[model samples]
Target: MAVAPSFKLPNVGPGPDPLSLSALAADNEFVLLLLQRDYHCGNCRKQVQVFADWYDEFHERNTEVVSIVPEPRERVRSWQEEYDLPYPLCADPEAAAGEEYDQPVRFGPLGRFSDLLGRMPKAVLLDCRDGDPTICYTHEGSSTWDRPELEEVFDAIDEQR
Candidate 1:
């Protein structure tokens, strides 16, 4: 389940672009897929900033990194500008992509109202070569303050090469 079989979601970055797994490797040799909590989550914003800081380093190794959140495109735009993110951003306001990616979500004190809960942070590395996308690694954040280590992420990237 850690390995993404195939997933395609709409990009809310520069334009209304289609980010498809079918054509992944062709567009970029590899992609570091990031699944984030909603914009309301302060931890999520900080996590994005960390990624933004290391964006160039990832690209230098031929890995294109992008982030996705369960938020509307308009809000996503604001988040990108606020963080000064350099990579493409994807919006899944309905949380459809989050469910597709099997990203965990929580509701609140009452279980009845939990389905629409915010997202949990996570990341996966995809080896998109030979016109096929393969999941090389997956990192799950266990808590609000959890974040994947840059060294571990880069190690996974190096493993792909």
Candidate 2:
């Protein structure tokens, strides 16, 4: 299942306000993965690297894959540089996008019992064609690194083309 929500946030590198999702969709089909800062887990870094690898291959086919991290611009840039990610890594510090996707930003063990209920890692794929965008897939929780399912997501995107 995919989540397609309307947003009017600032764009990267000074372009326009209320960025048009329709325009972006018309330009290219995209897969957006939302990530949170996990200071205690090295796996988050690896997860991003995996996405980067997929982005490289997908871009060649004219598919846009972007990862949005809920961090400040400087921090996001540092990670992008460190990982050598070739795609855009936008800053979504407030996790507004994540909430829009209906991911379990909250309701986890730590989140349910504490005040940190609104910070969780999740992924959402968007198939932006001539019409309104549609969500192609979604994954939330800890076992995001699991295979087969991940491969299935790529396959689904490929099938759309």
Candidate 3:
């Protein structure tokens, strides 16, 4: 049994407060969390837009895509408005969830070697079973948009259907 890393942080959304990973996975919904280090970076902004487009395609399959950033609520709101992101954009300034998934919480032009590098930019696929969760797939890379494994993951998800 692979246990998910323990992560406890304050939730910064409108509806629910203090959201848990287990709680997020209970509905058999596939969670695609796009981790970002900074909210002002152009690259990060572009990545969010790409994810928004992908989420449109993924919604038909009952999947939920979320973009997680280590920024304050105010900035997050601005970002949502600026990009017009279709999905939920949440904040994790303490990086509680990012730590659990070992996701990179920082970004820079230096690539992965960036001083702010915390967790790798990765996509995690989770399947809910009886309120618990199992990791179906994971893709980590310097850039989330250009990962080659994404296609394989899509194929695997399709196969399972």
Clash number for each model: 1, 1, 3
Clashes of 2: 1
For model 1, residues 52-156, the per-residue Cα lDDT tens digits are 898889989888787887777888878877877777788877767667766765564542234235456788888877556777788876666677889999998
The per-residue C-alpha lDDT of model 2 at residue 161 equals 77
lDDT of 1 at 45: 83
Ranking by TM-score: 1, 2, 3
Clashing residue pairs, backbone N/CA/C < 3 A, model 1: 107-114
Q: What TM-scores do the predictions have?
A: 0.84, 0.73, 0.72
Residue 46, model 1: lDDT of 80
Point out where model 1 deviates above 4 Å: 1-5, 14-16, 106-118
Stretches off by above 4 angstroms in model 2 are: 1-3, 8-20, 37-41, 106-118, 142-150
Residue 90's lDDT in candidate 1: 81
Best by TM-score: 1
